[model samples]
Target: MTEAPPDRRRAGISILSKLLAMLLGVSLLSALVAGIVGYRNGTDSLRAAAIERMIEVRESRAREIEAYMDSLRHTIILDSRGIAAQAIPELHDAFRELDEEPVPASEQAAVRDYYEQTFVPELEGRQGGEADVGALLPTSDAAWHLQASYTAADPDWDVRLATNDAGDGSAWSAANAKYHDFFRETVEQKGYEDILLLDDEGNVVYSAYKGVDLGTNVLTGPHSGGALQDVFEQAERATSVDTMAISDLERYTPSEGRPTLFAASPVGSGGQASGVLVYQVPMDEIDGIMTSGGAWEKTGLGRTGETYLVGPDHLMRSVSRGLLEDPEEYRDQVVANGTPRETADRQVAVTGSVLLQPVESFAVDESLRGRSGTGVSTDYRGHETLGAWMPLDIPGLQWVLVAELDTSEAFEPVRDFTRNLLISVAVLVLLVSLASLLLAQVFVRPVRHLVSGVREVAAGNLDARVAATSRDEFGELAGAFNEMARSLRTKADLLDEQQGEYERLLHTLMPEAVARRYQDGEETIAESHSDVTVVYAEIVGLDDLTRDMSSDEELETVNLLVRGFDEAAERLGVEKVRTLRSGYLASCGLVVPRVDSARRSVEFVREMQRVVAAFDAQHDAALRLRAGLDTGTVTSGLVGRQNVVYDLWGDAVNLAFSLPRANDRPGVFVSAAVHDRLRDQYSFREAGTVESGTGGSSTGPEPVWELEEDSRG
Candidate 1:
């Protein structure tokens, strides 16, 4: 340059440039620190919450399994108890009620007639009634001979007399016939496999299965063969023991198939073992329960989660995967060959604790002992797993029920969530930093122009104005500030003449409290307090009204009605919380407390009734309003962002909505609590107590008091 720069211009450039550089550096540093801290804290909190949620999920699954097993046990015990108590006694009573009394010769003919009519037809394919038919006949009667000749001879004579000894040969035979029929029809009809009468020596005296005869010793039969004899002998020897006899499928497996689950209980009489009632449930059927999906799937358990019953011998008796899968092969390959029976039994006998843990080779050790609960992380088939173990306290068998789940599969969602969260936090922090830096630069430039313009105006330059080059928020702010400065300069000339007009405009636009909040940049919600009743009123004629109007007209009319209702409520110092044109839900008494909420509610109803009456009178149509009221604590506050409005919530609000429908008086209904609150304050006619859907017993109907006001009085 040919000439040197002016000293003043150089000083201004040096000062303003240094100030802008310092501000930008400080802002960037602060943003970096805040963004880093926020991201770290948020990530840590989310991780902790995720872990807590997983723990809750695990505990919930454990509790559900425990409850399910408990329920199963309870149901089975109750079923068995019923069979012992009610069902058995009822069957015995039915036998006693059968007629066995002897009749006189005159009445005997009538008895014969009655027997032929009622009993003969039912015994057609059954036993031939030979022994009792001839003796029960009335020899002098012609009709009795016809009945006696048609009856067949009895097949079972000896067994009849041995069981019961109360009548003549013929009458005894008849009783035995009836008893046999009852046994087959009642017990067998209900799905009992075999009803066998056994001697103390375990000999089958009587059996539903005829192949197994009177002299056959059950102890020698295939049913009680092998190690089962020891179980049977133990049951017979121990008079106090009611333990069930359990057998392994391996012991009874036929060459054709796998072994089945067979159990037997000894029926004791007078402190002695009379017989053993053996029940054989095919392994497939028992496995069906052990693996049903309905029981486990409903509890949020997946197919990979399994429940299996392991016997004292470490053999799997039943397994359920909550899916359709065969467990027999799995049991044979994994359980049967895994552990020795003697070791498992010793562990169970010594500790009496159920075992639950993941195992590699199923080696028995002291590690398997204890009644206390614990979890183990281990490998199963090279896959890491989480196993929950519980002991099943079956009367005669020491068994463990273990539920195992694959850990990776179970916790995959949590892992993925954490990974995604970290990525999201990093991305969001980067975006915010970039956006803030841009905003800072944009705002700083505009602020510089504003500061320069203010200085120029202070120097008596009345025409000075800021140039807002963009239409964004900052640009709008700059334009407004420039307009304000220009107005201020003009106002200096006419300040006294405009003061009254400015004050009037300010008062009309905002109240003093609201204006203060706006000046301080605070968001405020309008609040009111008065001792006035609140009411919730619903219109009942909207369905009919909607049918007569187009959809657009219906919506418009509903909106107008809601506005009208809100206006009426506001005029009475009652806050209108919300309005649903179709359902007609409206609320009041939220902003203030009333001496009696019920009375306030009634007044609200009166006002609504008047409004609706006026509207109906003008239109020549009838309209109905239902109102509910309750007096209690409530909190009212503004809710939502874009379309913000006051809302009320509390038991009072709920009761108000509920009361009108309960009143069912065609106009308004109120609960008893509401009526009691308002009865002295308002002239209400009692419509007596009625059943209400709200506010009553947990299971029983609620009692609601109905009320109507006397308009004339």
Candidate 2:
């Protein structure tokens, strides 16, 4: 407590000041070190979480797109089956007849003006250049008339599909009137932009939307080298109902240069392809899925986040969210990012970015190489973003899906943490610990829930679902995972349905035992039975009865009679092998040997006669039933790979088929072998002889016996 000298007092004060300075330095250093480490770790974790979220979104979107494409394919294929069998021949004849019908000069001028004035101007507006109207003009008088009726007649583009007739009394117009609404309804209901039907010669016989491509030959038209033509050619070569073709997204001039994708399938029945059915896929459906209906935030794609598709040419196939939400900003960014100002302007003018924006980056390159994962790269807008990319599994199109989020938004939390830690040095440790705990709750817990749900689903529990406990990216991921599982369940059920259909089809084609052998991968399926009996029956006078009927009426009548025969055969325990145009071949004891195979064959023949008699009586027509039965050793087997058929062959089968032809009269006939077995149960009389058509047979003519009037027991 004593006062010291001035110099000693100043030295003591200096030492005290030095001690305070050292303490301040250590505090500042600790705060600085803590902020740097926290910021680094937080940013890394945030980036990883963002990338994982993007990957989830990318995979979900890819699956949706593939499912959509597959649905479209199935729709086209199912519609193509038997669609053109009768329509093609009728349209082809009508188209030919139109050639003989002259078109007035006024009609010709109208069609030309439609292409030169209405179509070309709109096309040039979208394409930013002139189009050759002459190349798109119809070259044939038939084409000219049809186009005048369908394309040029309707001045309103919206109502073009509703105009079935153009007041031109032409055969082509009549046919169009008959089928226009059906095709138009298909387009509207299925969300297709357009539907085109082409004849076997590649003539565009029908167009639902009446575009400029209608009435022109796709094989050799001006648009012949484009994607539509390629799909058409590929579809025309398809010989089965399941075979189809698809084209990449391209700007279709006929659609006013809009980005369009095309799918095609052959249209016919009976194992023959007679025409091609083409569908123009709407671009909006694809864009809607990629953009999530413009509610990106709801889908957990925060502001500046988007999903898009890139084709093999590296051009965008879906619309950009920036272009949709804010065109000016998108245009400016793209222009600044090396895109030509004119191109950016065009994208903005069209209100779309498809086919105009190019995404050249590591993500795209890797996706095109068939790799899938997440990474850091520059996006199409030239902003640094965390991206997830994968090749789409859609068939026949080489495309990729990319999900991206700008780094500024993804690292925003990290920045906030750093800023707060720097602002309040006293609370540095508390802030770091809080941020770490928050991040773990936000990302790790949700990820664990998702992993558990995924494991459950993978273990065959499709009903497993993760709780969408919050409105965050993790919640969105949970929803997407649930949707994927639901899709899988739906697909599994669909597979089961298809498997059942395949089984039914197989059984319809061959016996159950033979089908089992075929399913087991047997190369050759044949069975020999010595005691089998075959009954070959023909509906006599059917052709004469159906001579005056329309093709549809004839088919209906034949189907009705055949169905009745089938029901009767099933009731009598007879196996139906096959049915020809007017004949049915059935057998008994071939699959399960029976001592009364001859009796069963005779019973089947009697039942078939009853079916024909009922039909004749109902239609007030004169028709007869002729059938023959035989008992002998026979060989039964399936033939062909793609178009499979079941048949039996032997002396017995040959005699059963030939005996009905040999007897000029209409009745039930039996060979001697069958008569020998059934004579005790059924009364029989000698009807005559059936000489083998192969006349050099060493065995003489076989005797044929006719059943008595009261044959049924």
Candidate 3:
């Protein structure tokens, strides 16, 4: 259809007015959008960088904490293995100042009655029961006049319990005089509060401080269920020298009513445990690490930013910043949290630690449950905070590091940035409107040329260019546009290359199907497959191969073996799942269904054995690969967020892992389930039953089979 021509009489004034309106309208809208977009992009980028730094700091502090913990344990073990523990009888000489004379006849009768009547009943005749000393154990000289605490109300309670201790020269007092310097050095040098050595029978043989239990037996005295008792029991339970018994922080009446921890190792040489070396862990080092780490304000963390640790018990491993910096404020908050007056009073007064304080923060709770993530949440102190938390990788510990900042402080910079951006946008918009009105009249020709160039560029013409016909700002604008187009072309090519690399990396991490599902924004990428076979393989004699190599060389050797396995899995229709330490896991029929997953898995195992054998031959090394295979229905998914991994979970995988370790020889081990399916084409021999070390044994030893596969075939 043809359009009508414009009337000349209605053209001039109307067109100019319309153009002025269009310029102002476009200028205002564009300015608003540009300002908002710029502010959002800058804020997000800055926040991401800040959070990344916070995580780095958290991890750094976590490493320090982990090291400190390891050292504390090592110190306890060193002491346990030292001469002090080896020469238990010689320690008797140090208490020579305490007279061996019998108690006075008048006091002796009362002391005997008190032992039988007062301190004895708290035990209920049970070996592990603890005695309650009513409030705290009193070791004062006057208190000992009754052989225990003597309150005005209980003045006569000890009348039947007159002291054997009043004659002077206390066992504790004299022992302190001889060994106080040594024990004090341990506390000061090693960052421990109190140190205790328990005898084979759980008696407090030696202690750093005399104010607490010194002669009490943990098995049947005031210290039952205490650190010494617990450490002794743990030392007894340990079947090997490599293991030590460690206790989490808890209040102990034996430690003068303060929070303490005990780590015990068996003492005495080459025989049964003689005693336990216990350390009352000090909080100073831990507190210093947590609070001192984030004090650098340059990271945008502001006043409310801090990092701390939480343990499996949902208690703080470090002191709360508020408690250390402002105890009065902390006291008020605990009181407000409905802590009873008496409890609150005792809790705040329990100095030297906030270790056992329960954490009510959702971030800490979530992290303790093994979820690593970042978000906004209400913290333990009831403040809304931005937080990132992750579990530490330290062995024998279930701890998570939490980095947090209060919302008000965290976003203060963002708010300021946005305000400045808005003001700049407003001024720019006004100036641009005025310029647009004037420029619209003079630049119709230049605008036509620019629009034509932009259209050509949009149509994929990299060679499109505008002529600088007039050497003015319009000409400069044209040159800038051309330069931007050139930069765009270069960036697009680089982006394509990067995208390809990422795709390759992603597929290497997970199956292509799983990766696609994950990239499609699926929160949980899980798939269950029936009749899949899992192979757990470990390289043997790795110690011999890398014994003389440096750390980097050893790692390279391991990586070489892993790469070989990945290549074999690729050829055999198996998916490589994960490599943990020396163990490598892979499976068949995971992403794709197959009628013969068991056969493929066995073949893959043989191929892996060949690769390791060849590596041994080529390097003049003695490396070998052993594997265990099991076929069953299995589930697979991503297990972690920060270090996300494609992992498999089920009985088949567990049984396979167990099988490899069960057989001492480097060869293929298969479950009867796998043997039954592959016996038609393979030979096997019975190994033994799978002992699920939790006591109950099933899957009879006869069902496990050793697969004899010849890779040459």
Q: By lDDT, who's the top model here?
A: 2
Worst 10 residues of 3 by lDDT: 157-166
List model 2 lDDT by residue over 313-415, tens digit each: 9899999999988899999898888888998999999998888998888899999999998887898789998888999988899999999889888767767
Where is model 2 more than 4 Å wrong at Cα? 1-41, 82-85, 424-713
Model 1 misplacement above 4 A: 1-199, 203-218, 226-231, 241-265, 277-297, 302-304, 312-315, 322-383, 393-395, 432-620, 624-713
- In order of appearance, the predictions have TM-scores of 0.45, 0.56, 0.50
Task: Please report the candidate that would top TM-score against the real structure.
Answer: 2
Model 3 TM-score relative to the real fold: 0.50
- What's the lDDT for all of these models? 0.48, 0.84, 0.69
Model 2 poorest 10 in a row by lDDT: 8-17
Give candidate 3 misplaced runs (Cα > 4 Å): 1-15, 92-101, 105-181, 293-301, 331-357, 393-397, 438-713
Global lDDT of model 1:
0.48
